[model samples]
Target: MAENGALLRVENLVKSFDGLRAVNNCTLEVRKGCLTGLIGPNGAGKTTLFNLITGFLKPTSGRIHFNGERIDGLPPHLTFRKGIVRTFQVPRELKSMTVLENLMLVPSDQAGERIWNPWLFGFRVSRQERQIYDKALQILEFVDLQHLRDEYASSLSSGQKKLLELARTLMCDPQLILLDEPGAGVNPALMKRLVERLELLCHELGITFFVIEHDMDLITRLCNPVIVMSNGEVIAEGSPEEIKGDERVLEAYLGGQYLAGT
Candidate 1:
């Protein structure tokens, strides 16, 4: 059902704000079942491109295809129903809700959500609620946040909140997940665990990922055929080894920090 084995494709994508092109004639693809990485220096239009793909922003001109269907102008909720979900650089959890509740809220159009349906179909509503609760618990366990399930999301540390964000995405049963800076503020220990879970999701669960991060270490560890963006267009795509040795990549953004890390 995929086009050229690609789950998502963007062709000649462009977005401009008051004549300032934030994403200029960009083109890329996220192949099915691969953990793809998107990297660039600050202001390379990574986040802006994500906004366009996820339907937070409409493109000035371009085509976006998912599962071979044109979906360039769908709203966020509609795009989500197409099984593409995204997480933010800053985790957006409900501060007043427990971690479990946060995951429970992700599924769309629950039978229990309608007041009259819940009253009329009490048994069905209860059964669905129980199933959702169990699934939420399993996801929390996978992200190593099961112990914190009952705690308010506000009580979680920065790393734990990231884990919670990922768990919420899983509840949507997504095929392609765009992660924006999953390693941004996470501690090294938590980051390792998060990486392990992401790998398992890609390899075992057959989920695909498109990630944006400044952490080259995490990018190299988890992504292959990395895509580099500069001034709003893709400039390179290759494995981490190839990318590291690429003169263009080094000169564009990896000049100092990447070499220092190595």
Candidate 2:
């Protein structure tokens, strides 16, 4: 049953590509202000499910509701405007742009981009740019990337790029963030910082997160009521402890290992 205060709801969702089901008959609800985890082995349709919910791929059937309103068939940008945003496994920063410039570009409301802005509104654009700059710097400091603010995004380390992506997402003032393997390829030292920042975002900013991760340690530490998928459908959902001990989950992970390496 969908909770009354649920922030996201999916009912009997289905998606197919070339007559092959990528996500099959899925139904779930993400409660308001909760950190939820979606986990599975490789090719488990985890990313496919995320793409469906975020509007990267349209569902073949079923319904999606966000904040009690139907949002199926909406484009990705419209979904983003509705306070839903997603991060990629690899950070998508402009290599040539400075870190601050990258963050400054995340917010979509740009007055100067309009054709009439230059002639009709000179100082307004300047004021808005200054305000955006200030906010971008504040976000940089928040992510502990202030020292690298002026550096080319390409020059930063992989972990720093991930942080920059998170900073850019924050610029949108999102209500829900769908994270795709946030800790993947990050170093241990910076990975800790990433975890801390996510926790703070949930606790302080009241943002909801639905994360897809392979790192069981990260999932155990940060997520609750974890949802597991395999073969294009949800297999199980429970707390970290329960999931760890689940026979089906063990089979999903260890069964192949036993056959391949034994």
Candidate 3:
């Protein structure tokens, strides 16, 4: 297990595509129970770093530490089994599945998963399914989507789909959640709701979040100790307030006018 108190840590992490380094010798730590933010301009390699950490892409060099063990090149499913889960910029749901079923499908190693077990051990499988269903209902209500539990995932609005996605992640009881962009297409009202739910999850449930976001306003309002990446490398790390005024950050992405206005 990862010692000290960092839930996730990357040291000298690097990735390259056709000799073009996308994440170059980057190093960062996400402490346990933190709602940390990662933000940068387009092509800043933020997503690539997320990919590396989540095992979507293996690092060309360096190590990734999660909960004190080296999880550098583990497959995505294995990484998830180890309690590091990631959601994409675009929510991916089983469109034909009900919201409740979608949530039920995330917790791996379910007794109902084995093709033979469900048949030979029907009662056991049924009991397990009931447990998963009950858990799914609770998660749906936690994310305020219980009313839509029976609705097809495709029927949900974009914001509701985002909520569904967040609900599904809770099924695994992950230690760290890598959110690509929770506020990407959400409207102000829904974004506020999402932020509030996440804050409650962080402070109350103590779920750790390592987020990648572009909305500076959302970042400033919701995050602390934001990490900024530029040109495939981390350029700065500090509080949201400090980042808003940093000359380098303003020059790289947020222009002086925008910084001044904020």
lDDT of 1: 0.90
lDDT of 3: 0.88
What lDDT tens digits, residue by residue, belong to model 1 across residues 1-262?
A: 4568999999999999998888999989999999999998889899999999999999999999999999898989999999999998888899999999999988587898887997799999999999999999999999999999889999999888888888999997899999999998899999999999999999999999999988889998999979998888888899988877778877787464653564
Candidate 3 per-residue lDDT over residues 175-208, each given as its tens digit: 8888998888888998988999999989988889
Q: How does residue 220 of candidate 1 score in lDDT?
A: 86
User: Where does the lowest 10-residue lDDT sum fall in candidate 1?
Assistant: 253-262
Global fold similarity of model 3 (TM-score): 0.95
When 1 and 2 are scored with lDDT, the better candidate is 1
lDDT of 1 at 187: 99
Off by over 4 Å in 1: 254-260
Model 2 scores what on Cα lDDT?
A: 0.87
User: Model 2 off-target regions past 4 Å?
Assistant: 256-262
Residue 238 displacement in candidate 2 (angstroms): 1.1
Best by lDDT: 1
